[model samples]
Each structure stands twice: as structure tokens, then as C-alpha cells.
Target: MADDKKVLDDGELVLVKDYVEEIITDLKYSTEDNFTLKVIYNYSDAYLRYGTVKKLKKAQEIFKKKGYRIKIWDAYRTVEAQRFMWEIYPDDDFVADPNIGFSNHNRGTAVDVTLVDEAGNELKMPTGFDDFEAVMNYDPEDEKNKERTENASMLNEIMTSCGFRRSTTEWWHFNDTDKYPVVEGFNSII
Candidate 1:
């Protein structure tokens, strides 16, 4: 991980694993298993702005005390990647339009995450990653949705308290607002 330690400290974009230990990364865009059914990202690593990394480090410390950790699904997307994703999903509520406003992820200030137990298994949430249903909203009121909602509520409480904004539709998405840079090419920063 020497190269990781060297190249990953870019002030504009740094891999989350550099500061957040044991943070599992599931780069959805780097595989065919995603909504696109094709690889989007050329590489697989959760990269965010350095400032975001420091904020996440704080969040991880808090989660660690609670016997939980963050598992990341995706982070640091290029506009080209977003365009390809839009071609497949095309839902503005979920996929941001590359032609218009930039995605928070493109800014290296956003992350898609879920809480995991000490054993490293993700806690049960309202829906799995990429689930766009209304029930996937952070908290649902139905008794059947209690565990899921409570789990999401817990994530919301932790991330928000740590300075990350929760997404209204995707329970797993969060943004570190103060350090947003909004970019078009993921490699441009490198």
C-alpha cells in the first residue's frame, strides 16, 4: 500500500481507505453487476476530497465506538460515468444529469455508504444499494419497516451529526458539504 500512501494524499481526491480503516469498498461502477450492466469506472477505489476524508475519519471514530463501521458502495464519479449511468437509469431523482448540475460524487464530496456490524456485515436497511423505490426512503412508518427505518435512522443520525448530508431518496448516500469541488473527469485531479 506504499503507492496508495503516496498518490492517495491528493488534496483534491484521496481514497477513503487512507484515513478510514477497514472501510469496505464495493465500487458499483467498476463492475457489470451495477444498474448499467457494464463497467463504468476504470478502477475501483472510494476516492473523495482530502477534507472529506478528515470528516469521514471523524465519523468512523464515532461508529467504531458503537461497534459499527461504514461500508462504501461508490464515490468520486466522473461526468462521463454519470452520462453512461444516465443512459441506463435516467432517473433524475436518483441519477443526476451530467448535462446539467454536477453530482455530489463528482465533486469528491459525496459517498454511498451503509453501516456494518463489528463482524463486517452490513446492517439491514430499507433496501439494498440501487433500490430506487419510495420505500427506500430513510425512514418508513410501517411496522414491517421499523427495523429498516430504525437502521436508516441510526445512519442518518450518525452521518448528519458528523457533517454529512443524507440523501432524501437513497438512504446510503451522504455528502460532506463544506469541501465540494464539482468536477467532470475523475482523472483530472490526478
Candidate 2:
């Protein structure tokens, strides 16, 4: 994690762009319109970095085993992008404060991903990414959203068992604990 004062203003390289490019091409998937790989950012928002190329590949492998694929929403966000999130939800604790330091994406340790069918449509989950509520927690019996909750729990379990941690608020978000240290302020090259 980057210190509050160590965030980069110009952004640094995180994942090698070729890594993302090669993976996308190899998978025969198309990038979403708003995100780098054409997935939606911030739950259908803009395109940016919230994941690294390598992470996406790993996610793809995991999803593939389950007969699905990973659909990335966002990856490698810039400081300005984080500022945009702050404007929309100032009280948000999920998004890192730009002033405090770089984000996980800046470090290339985090990812916002969803399970999708062969056609690339999203599956049911507790809530959409960045939903900002307990509704997204991996509870199996939250009546208000039971089906989604169970599914979210399943995803969380799978991801964590594979060394990824859920972001608490976003069912689709995950990160590799080991990769956290060197990722601060690392730039995205979508």
C-alpha cells in the first residue's frame, strides 16, 4: 500500500498492457464499451483500471472451470478517477482516498469482476459492484436478496479459496493479498 504522500500524479505502470491484450485476444472476448476490456466501470460507469492484466487472467481461469468467464468492470483507475467516485459518494470507505495514497488498482493488486455466461451477460449476485450496502455481503440468508446473497457467497468463497479477498461492499471485487505491497500508484495501460 502507498503512503498518503506517495501517490503518483502522473501514474506509473502496473500491469504490462500486452498482458491484458494477449489475454483478451486469447479468450476470444471483447472489451466492454465503458471499461478497458469493454466492461462497465463502477457498476456501469466509465472505463478505467480497477484490476491488473494478470489478475484478469487468473480470474478467467477460475471462471472457466465453472463454465463461465470473468467480465471486468474497471481496472487501473487514476487519482482523478478516484476523485470522481468521491464526488458521487463522499462518505464511501470502499474507494481509497486519493490524498491518503494510491489505490489497489494503482498497485495492480485489486480487481472488480463478475461471473458471466458464454454470451458475457452478468450472473445474479448479492448486489452490483459499488452498491454501498450490506446487501452486497456474502450472506446466504439475507431475505431481501437471498438468491443474490448465496451466489455472492459462492463467488467470495471461490475467490478467497484461491487467495483473493472480497471487498466487503462489492461482491464482485477481489484482491491478492501477496500482491498488495508493491502495487501503490502503479499506472494502468489499457
Candidate 3:
């Protein structure tokens, strides 16, 4: 039990565990609708929970004061749900490659989010989060896709500046310092 880290309880569709306070501050976080699905999709038996709710609230307060807000693309996706995504986009590099050993979602310490205006309007990203294309991942020099590239770059800068790292593939995805040891069986959190 680290003083700054805490296990997340499944109270909502998303499963986000709290991390070190500095880690939370550095992550520039948000939870989107899909992020919620990430948490409980595999373990339907487990209750829903969103780990970053508190951090998000705090971050939102600051962003809102600046006339900006957060938007989400996906949240707490279960390993099973990720598998489904792998099946649907087998060749898609934007998401985790199933052949890869693990994913942040499986560890319950990651989230997908973007920025929005005070009105809650999301700015565009390099590509739609789930879009199955190299261009959607993080190709910064694709002159043909300037809009998406710029969007992805901006989002990545914000998230990374806060201490989150960007996946070479998906710009909206990020991980927290607190990583789960193993994928727990879906249990009733709520």
C-alpha cells in the first residue's frame, strides 16, 4: 500500500485505479465512454469502477478554469474486450497487437482521452481512436493528413507534458505509474 496509490473499486463501467499523486498530475487524464467499456467488458461479473474519477475531477477543474474540458474515447476495457478488438482489427497497428504479451488495460492502469472546448466539443485527433490504419496511429509527417496529425500531436503533447507517454500507434492512449500485478477476475465492485 503506497501512500499515493490506491486500488480502484468498480463503481462505474470504467476501471481506473488511483496512482501516485505526482503520477496523476503528470498524466493529464480523462475517461471516455469506451474507456468505461474497457473495465468491465470481460468480467461482467465484476462491478464497474473508474479509477481516475477523482484525478479527472481535479484536472477538469483546472482545465475548465481555462475554458477547456476533457473528452474520452475509451476506458477500462477488459482483456476479453481487447481481444475482440484484436479480432476486428487484426492488422490494425493503432491498438495493441494481440501477439504482444500484455496491455495497460489488462493491468487496470491506463485510459484513453482527449481535450475539448468549454462546450464539451472534442478537438479532432490524428485519427479516430479505433481506426485501423497506420495514419491513425502517430505519423507526424503525413502531409496529406495534416489535420489528424496536428490533432494527435497536440493531444500527445498535453498528455505527455502531464507525465503520460504516448503510444507510437494511438495518440489518445496513455498509462499511469500504478500498474496492476495481474488481470483479476471480474468481481462485483459495485
**Number of the top candidate by TM-score?**
1
lDDT of 1 by residue, 1-190 (tens): 3243455443567767766766788888789877677999787878888878877878888888999988888888887888888888888989898888878888888899998998888898988888776444444767888888888888899889888999877888998867655764456334
Q: Give the poorly placed runs of model 2, Cα more than 4 Å off.
A: 1-56, 133-140, 180-190
Question: Evaluated with lDDT, which candidate comes out highest?
Answer: 1
- Candidate 2 lDDT over 109-187, as tens digits, reads 5667767777766778766555556443445655867767666676777677666778755666676665533333422
C-alpha lDDT (0 to 100) for residue 159 of candidate 1: 85
Off by over 4 Å in 3: 1-62, 97-100, 134-150
Residue pairs clashing, model 1: none
TM-score of each: 0.88, 0.63, 0.60
**lDDT of all predictions, in order shown?**
0.80, 0.52, 0.51
| Candidates 1 and 2, the one with greater TM-score | 1
Query: lDDT tens digits, residues 1-190, model 3?
Result: 1233545453333422332221121121122223223332433221113444444445555566667665644445556666765765566455566466556765655666677775656666665545545444555676877876676666566555554566666676776544454355644263
Please say which candidate is ahead in TM-score: 2 or 3.
2
lDDT of 3: 0.51
